[model samples]
Target chain A: MLAFQAGNLGAFQALFAKYQKKIIQFCHRFCGDQAMAEELAQEVFLNIYRGAAGYRPKARFSTWLFQIAVNVCLNEMRKEKYRHRIDSMDASPETESGKPRIKELCDPAPDQNELLEQQEREMMIQKALMGLPEKQRLALSLRVLNGFSYQEIGTQIRCSESAVKTLIHRGRQHLKELLENLYAGGDKS
Target chain B: MTCPYETWISAFMDGELTPQRADAMADHLAGCHGCKAKYEALTGLDQLLQSLPELKPSEQFERTFWKKVADWEENRSRRRLADWFKRGWRTVLAGSLALFILVFVSVFQGRFTRSLSPEEIILAEQMDVLQQYELINNLEILENWEAIAGEDESS
Candidate 1:
């Protein structure tokens, strides 16, 4: 980072090459949409690279980067348009029936019914994730999906290790109960 | 049934539990069938969640990201330049003010040296404004003072 701050473009290139995919993956988990994740990832890197000159290493660079990533995702979520759209979508009957909002946007063909089942299950998972409180979902995703350590997750989430643990606990418990209920309902149907 | 060690189960899963705490929780799980079931269920949840597929970005993602970094670096340079200019301008203002005071004092001592601390400077300004107002307001009385003095002498 210091090298990049000192006008070394090669250093910046190397850092971007190293972190781009991981950042994109993290963003994907945050927003659950590939295209939007990619856009947010771009913004994350842009902010990091822009602030490199002023970057003092208080925490590990990865922790700082993920912190920025979370902030970007939160910012994107806070936009009035995005929040309003989500509100109306959640209010719609189709979503109220527990169908993932993404499912309503894409329909399955008769021949691809099996594919639809898989997509629906995945979309359901995404919806369950979105249903979680923001901090819980983030902590859970960072630990489970992203494989970050409790310490690292704490640094990223700006909480203590114990708090991160609690978030993960509640998030996992909530998700498990949610999926169990859904599966039970499906079995009866 | 609510298990007291439910959160401990999660902590143990994260490998965050201390040795003594882990053992106590483990003992509870071993003795309590309910907690044991909950533990198994939570472990299953963790396994299933960890099994989520990792999606790889498109090949062009790297290219586009680097492009963004480059564009950001350019903008940063412009902003840095502007910031430097702002700092420079502020320093220039302070330096010129100091130099003006030094030259004025050397050329005319006590003739009206504006050598006042910030607080006194404000008070001096208020007094100056009041004196100017008093002069303007008493102008009509001063103009008629000569005729008034002659009438007093005749009386």
Candidate 2:
């Protein structure tokens, strides 16, 4: 980063290469759309470039980068006026058969029926994730998906460590409840 | 034995607890069926999360991103040049004012040193006129001296 700040284009490119996947993944989880995620990821890098001169090593680079990502995603959400909705996860019927045929050709250990079911479950989880309040979703994603430490999550989300833990806990509890409601017909015993 | 176990269980699941605390929580989970059930459920959730597929970027993502970065850098440079131009204009304006003041002072000083007094100027002009009148009178005396001398002797 210092090298980039010193006008090293190669250093900048190296940094971009290092973080592009993780940043895109983070934005994808936030927006639930690959295209929008890419857009947001680009915005995040642009912000880093613009703010590079002022980048003090006050925190780890990942923390600062995630902080910028969170802000960018939140701002994009606000601008687009996105409303959260909860629903049972289902695969798009058009793509499902084609994707599974490709997967089956690659590896045969996983049964196609089981894979489809697992994919639906993941889709449900994604839908549930979307239903979570933005802050909770961000906290949960940072902790669970990104494997950020509590303190690191706090730094990125601008909250205390304990608060980050609480957000994760509350987010998980809410998700568990929502899932139970969706699968209400199943016997708990 | 009565400590709140759920909090420690969560910390344990998150790998946040110290090794000793984690061992204690594991021991408690071994003996307590309720805590064990909760732990199992949480563990299942974690496994489910880990099983979620990683998303891959679409083809041409890199090319598109580099283009955007290039455009952004160009725009930033343009903005910086405009700001510099604005500051340059201000500097030029200030310098021109300073130079104007310096030139005005130099001209004023030169005029102060070489200028004439009003009385001296009027006296010099009167002396020139007096010399001219004496010369004219001498010329008239030369032209009619005998007649003028006879008139003066009679008077």
For this target, which candidate reaches the highest lDDT against the unseen true structure? 1
Residues B1-155 of candidate 1: C-alpha lDDT, one tens digit per residue: 57777768888887889999998998898899988988899889878766555556655667887787678768879999999897989889999999999998778876666578898778687987767987888898889999989999999
Lowest-sum lDDT 10-residue window in model 1 chain A:
A89-98
Per-residue alpha-carbon lDDT of model 2 for B1-155, expressed as tens digits? Answer: 53478767666889888899999998999998888887787777667666667666656678888898889879989999999897889889999999999999999999988767898788678887766877876887788989999999999
Clashing residue pairs found in predicted model 1: none
Question: What are the per-model DockQ values?
Answer: 0.27, 0.23
Q: Estimate, for each residue in A50-156, the C-alpha lDDT of model 2 and write its tens digit.
A: 89999998888888899999999988888734433111113342222244322421234477677777655665676667778899889988888888899999888
Candidate 1 reaches a DockQ of 0.27
Model 2 stretches with alpha carbons more than 4 Å out: A84-115, A183-189, B1-3, B18-20, B96-155
Reproduced native contacts, each prediction: 0.65, 0.33
In the range A1-189, model 1's lDDT, one tens digit per residue, is 778889897887788778887888777667766666788888898898768878988877777888899889888888885565455643442433354434433344344565467556765576677778889888988888767889999888889988898899899889888887777877898
Instruction: Return the lDDT, model 1, position B83.
Output: 93
Off by over 4 Å in 1: A84-117, A185-189, B76-155
